[model samples]
Target: MPMVPLLICDDSNMVRKQLLRALPSGWGVSVTMAANGMQALEAIRQGLGHVVLLDLTMPEMDGYQVLAAIRAQGLSAKVIVISGDVQAEAVRRVLELGALAFLKKPTDPQALHKVLLDQGLLDPSQQTVAVSRAVAEPVTSFQDAFRETINVAMGRAAALLARVLGVFVQLPLPNVSFLEVGELHMALADAQGNAQLTAVCQGYIGGGIAGEALLLFHGSEIADMAQLMQRNSADYSDMEMLLDLSTILIGACLSGIAEQIDVVFSQGHPQVLGMQAGIDELIRVNQTRWKKTLAVEISYSLEGHNIHFDLLLLFTEDSVERLSRKLAYLMS
Candidate 1:
């Protein structure tokens, strides 16, 4: 039998490059590409591939429409919807529409490969449990203690950001959960749409304890931020102001966490990007680098004011594992 063929349908060339890089090396399969749903359908009609990696937003036709079309034609190929638009309703709809699984953009290569294997589309023998039984009894005391510790560390980060901006900043206690990269994107998008600006930063924590952190901000409240920074109005453009604010917020947040945890850390400068771009562009940009997405969302409020913004921190698999280990140690 001929080796199976896979089709990758996405609008961005960058994302295509990343996906190609992330896929397992020896899957005995060939890959094809399509820029939109219409092209994907044509490729399928031609009997081109056995698997389709579909993107949700495209210029000509969206992923949902293509999925419906595929089902209508009774095409037997499996589809996996890969996107950064993480609304619960969207996930629910796609599942109902017959998409086999959903992977967020910047997907982890290992996770994606495992999903493929689990579906029997690939020959790998990896198995993932949806829910694992706890090996030890629940420790409520340590859980509460660590939660409080993280809260204080986050607060200190907020205060540092406020000092840098010369405004009062509020860092809300986050609702913690184990999140994949796609789910993190959804949460950030929901928050970003409601806020003015968002800033993102990535870095590791340590002193023998290490992990990653992300910071976000609201762009609309530039005036307040400028006031806090003690900078004159003529000093910055909208984008420049946002970048500067990110540098400060990220720096402070990381520094604060280090102090509270008694862990030492160093950071890289912020790489500022627009989060309000169209979903297609965002997916395209991220797909160039990451295979799996692991991120954290932190919300910030300006003290004595209604101004609020979101912070998103992204990490690679290595970083995530390191953080998980640290969290486990702290809880223990």
Candidate 2:
């Protein structure tokens, strides 16, 4: 069978190139690129490409909107979403909207190749894993090791969400960093942007490691979430779904991290921070309590919807020393 035309879409120049560059040599597919949802939609509408390698989080148009448009127009393109939006709801939403496959961002060459093979988009005899620099080299750096560890945990969280929502979750690049709370907003400026936002803060502590997991949702995306949760967009329904989404994503994420480090976190009740346009203004918590925090941020986007969110697993200063030692153990 002839390989189908592939359109790689993402806002990041590196990611777009990574997807295109990682393709196997002599693969019979034609390739193209799109930087945003609008551009992706236009490309598909104009028959520029049929098989899309889509990114979920983008300005103007996101993967969710592009998937929605593809479904609305009944496009015949086989869309495979390759993004970092690992939320379970996001995965299920896109497949429902007609995605052929869902792969995580900075996707594995083996995984990408497998999707193509299974979809009959490539001849299996000629398809082989294309090893790229993007592959994890855990022992090379402490950060890389932790990223891999969290990447494993992120997959566990995604699997849980997939089971519950009956959808495939897009695994995102887990951001492992050391920063002060005041510095976090700038670090995540692109993900948060100027969109109105809502957040769920859950505190976790165990084995001398303690911190908060903050799940931030786009305010305008609440209605889409309500619909995904199969509930009316009433105030009560919204709150209920918000709580439900928080419990699953946060719980699974924290649990995955603890399981890897061989520790357990006693979680506190999730606090809803409500909605506001200004992310800094919307958060009511004091940042100065901790001089620095270990921030593990995952930017999540729901496929086939106009929503993108972040799951920030923030560890306190005192806990970092202990957490570092524990994380170091994995590298041994």
Candidate 3:
């Protein structure tokens, strides 16, 4: 059989260049590029490719709109959403719209290849398992190792945040759990119920970093966070204070993770949302298709400090691919 043709759609030439650079060599695949969704659709309509690598945030016609149009036309081509938007609702929405998979920005080459292979777009003969493990071995050992790593990383993050706020930080013991998409609502509900204050930030991390990261706070710690940011400034409103706190806390957390992961993340502006309302809306939006769950939860506390925040590292299915690649490398 002839190799599959791949279509990459992104507004950024830089991103397109990176994708070309990162794709595996000798894949017997033909790659084509488009500047935006309209171009992508036009290419598809011309039957130029059987698979599409799509970006969600394009001008004129975004990935979502393109996907809707493709479905309306009953296109058979497989689509993989390559985006930086990590919002649960957004991921869920795209996957529901018939996307074959979702790969977050800065995708790992090994993982992407595996996704292609799993979808039968790439020949299995060209694939290799990056990690060596006995088939009979229980998977729990791998989970244990990853759980420890995440605990250490989160612990360092909590410490860094505590220092920035000059308050005591308490972190819950780490737990390893797998979740289905449908169970996401329950998982997020439980996470939100215990949180006192929530603040979110969007940014990019790693080489060519271009993605969003959210830092959630508990309700009780909201006031403390406001106070910490206001300590040095006099004329800041509640909203301003919240934004400042998000900047500080998210910066600290991202810095700590970067140090551990050996990656650099560029910071972006912070956005504060109504805690309960935001979580509820997210749950409602994703409840339909994201019923299966797979996530790791960590809790931390800032004691003797005015604000307490819970840092959640929410990972979608695409994140799992990224995590698997990272873990394989670490194990190696």
Candidate 4:
């Protein structure tokens, strides 16, 4: 039998390598790799592979786009979706877009092998290592601790928002990173696809720590948010609703996070960065102003509703060392 073509797509080199390692090395499969959605689609069009291992959150393009391209062009490639976003809604979205399977991150080898076998893509004669599942949980590190810390804070924020609007909010897995400021916008997968948005910015300082919190909403979110607040959509301006929503969500979230970290924050008034502006035009500061920053991002959506938004908290590079110390203290 001829070797089958398999394409691995992910932005992280480490993840791609891990995916390769998880497979049987002796299988008659020719592996090709792509770093992002565009590259993945190009490879498929070029006939480099017929089976794709696609990741959801990537800079430049996301898995949804790649899957859509596959469906549009009548490509024969089969896609298995992989991501850390375990929300049932997120999984359902990927499957709805033409993915053949979904696997959450840090995929158990047993489960992965089972997926391949069930898909009839695994060769029974191949030799593969039965790796042990003895590794400590990946979410145990300081980074992950910070993620969990913000996750709890996010839940509090959701509850507060729910009470204020009397509507349930769809929570997402928070993404935390220490990355270059120029690369910050690329970190938001849910927000990047929109053509236009309205964003609000607020400053906060306390306990010798300072940073900015950004609340972004898709252009269509204003109506849903206003309706949730039980207001006539035509009565208030979009900016008014945007600021009000940002104040409630960002204020509660920041306070909850500060309390957990044993700190305090004095928040500044919400500033309308832009209403109905492209994301690139929303940033009031220079892109490269800070070489790097510590950031926490949460993509929040309303359950059974079309409302969705993202919250990004960015701290200057100088503050991260101190922040790391605080995270370590909390871990202890």
Candidate 5:
């Protein structure tokens, strides 16, 4: 029997490795892994991908563009999208672009096997073997594991927001970095660029993990946000709207993360960090909070609307070791 040409494409090394570990042991397949859409396309063009397992949120190029490109060039690769972006619109778009199936992140091995067999991509005889639980590869870094964790949480938060607002939420690749206080300020400044903002901060701590979650909104977009929420601008104060949004997004996002890492966070009361202020002003006020920290930044926008917001999860420097240990347990 010939080995099936299987390709797994995802931006996170942890997730790619997870997929590899989920494959049926009895199925004969030569696996190829791509870290991004560009590499996935290059491998496909070189005839390395007969069955492509793809991810949606990625740098350089995303899975959506890859699907479109595959269709345009008439590639025979059958794509099964494995993504953390589980929004209805995301699923619809990928299916329309020619993905064979859409599986949520942290994919179940039995579910994946079923999809392969149902799609006739796997032989029926392979079903005799149960899925493997062995960790086939080491996670490349703590950052990859942490970012993939937040990616799933980010999708949950977005899905909740979308359901409440009756609008599709556009998700970005969650950026994870460890930086000094000064570098953190510069990064935030570059992202906001002097725009007036309303922001809230809430702290969470439990089981040796502690961090602050900051939700930032552009002041100019408040009116559009009010319109979407069906609240009259004159009746609802801007502060009220900002706090409401922060509670929904920050609370949901943090809860999602805690669920995945097997911890519960007792959250501090949400505090208004700044209203109609610049990024520098906000950072200056809170500069003494930490010397260096791990920051996970995610931006979300409402489809067909002018509403946008950014969520930042800042874990203290001392918490990195705890986080790495927790991630190791989860991956195991």
Candidate 6:
């Protein structure tokens, strides 16, 4: 092959750079970059993407949309999806939509290399420049690195939940922000809308990282959740369903993050913050306890179902520097 035209599509700058560095050293390819699906489609249209590496959760257009477009437009781009969303449905859907393969997040270089070789995209004997400089370059900042970390953790959580519920989880682009108590209230309002909500809060502390995990469920959706969980009406109540969900999502998500940053956390007992309360009421009860926080929000929806919930990871302001140091060490 003279040169393969490859496109790397992901919203994270860190992820894009990592993929570039992960390319086979001797692969003969001209690489194009896209931050979202629209750009990826445009690049393919321009003949810049004979091969596309796609990430699933992105703003504007997601990987699923890109795959659909590639099929609809009769484009010849061979798409290999790379995403943190590891749900079984996610993999099945990508393949069904015309993706050549699906790889999990925080990609393995050897695995990627093997895939390329197996797919005849690489020649085993070829030798090219090493990615030493790319290796040396750390992620741009703590925020970007932290957000990407959450992105991966979010997927792990969703995957577990999807497995337990036997439903496809629709993932959102994680929302990360540093906010004051007032701003946090506003953000919660936007997330929950006017729905009455029930929430569970759990605190975790270790390795100089301390925060609370809050899982919010819409009041009207608890019955839907109960149905999906296949709960015995005589055996489980709405509150039981809520706590169970909190345990699965919050535990898996925190464990995922901890595994990446090399931290071990001791978790506090889950507290029922409120049931059938408005967003304002929920925040008011906790307002005095939080001043400033680093908040990571993930809204997960069940495919073909009306069930949706928001999981918020709130790190204390004091924990930011310690977490930053941890990420810096990991990236380094």
Model 1 lDDT tens row, 1-332: 35567888876554555566566766655677887899999988887658888877565888889989988999877998876444444566788999999886556788888888888887653222122221122233333333333444555556556556555554444433445556656755665465454545444545544334444555567666666666666757655776676766666656654564556776655544354343334445554333454544567776587577765555454544545444554444
Across 186-214, the per-residue lDDT of candidate 3 in tens digits comes to: 65566557645455645444643233445
What TM-score against the true fold does each predicted structure earn? 0.45, 0.55, 0.46, 0.54, 0.89, 0.90
Between candidates 1 and 2, the lDDT winner = 2
Q: Alpha carbon lDDT of residue 186, candidate 6?
A: 80
Comparing 1 with 4 on TM-score, the higher-scoring candidate is: 4
Global local distance difference test of model 6: 0.84
Off by over 4 Å in 3: 1-140, 189-214, 229-234, 259-268, 275-277, 280-294, 305-307
Candidate 2 global CA lDDT score: 0.71
Which should have the higher TM-score, number 4 or number 6? Answer: 6
Query: Candidate 3 — what's its lDDT?
Result: 0.62
Residue 106's lDDT within candidate 6 is: 92
Cα deviation at 18, candidate 1, in Å, is: 45
Q: Which portions of model 1 show Cα errors greater than 4 Å?
A: 1-149, 185-215, 259-264, 275-295, 327-329
User: What is candidate 2's TM-score against the reference?
Assistant: 0.55
- What residue runs in model 5 are displaced by over 4 Å at the alpha carbon? 127-139, 185-195, 232-234, 275-289, 330-332
lDDT of candidate 2 over 1-332, digit per residue (tens): 44556678876655665576667664666666777888888888888677888887667877888888887888878888876556666777779888888887557888988898889777766545332332232223456556655665676777676677555555466778888666765654544464476677778899998877778888798887777666754566676688899999889888877877889889988777534333454333536535687778787654455667788887778887786688664444
- Deviation in Å, model 2, residue 284 alpha carbon: 8.2
What's the residue-level lDDT of 172 in candidate 4?
A: 62
Cα RMSD of predicted structure 1: 17.6
Per-residue lDDT of candidate 6, residues 1-332 (tens digit) = 46778899999888887888788877877888898999999999999899889999988998998999899989889888999999988898999998888899899988888888887777777646442322233355777889889999989988999889998888898888889998887877775564577778888998988888888888899899999889977778878878888988899999999988899988887776644444567567657656888999888899899988889998888889889888875354
Report lDDT (Cα) of residue 93, candidate 3: 82
Cand. 4 Cα-lDDT: 0.73
Could you tell me which residue pairs clash in candidate 4? Answer: none
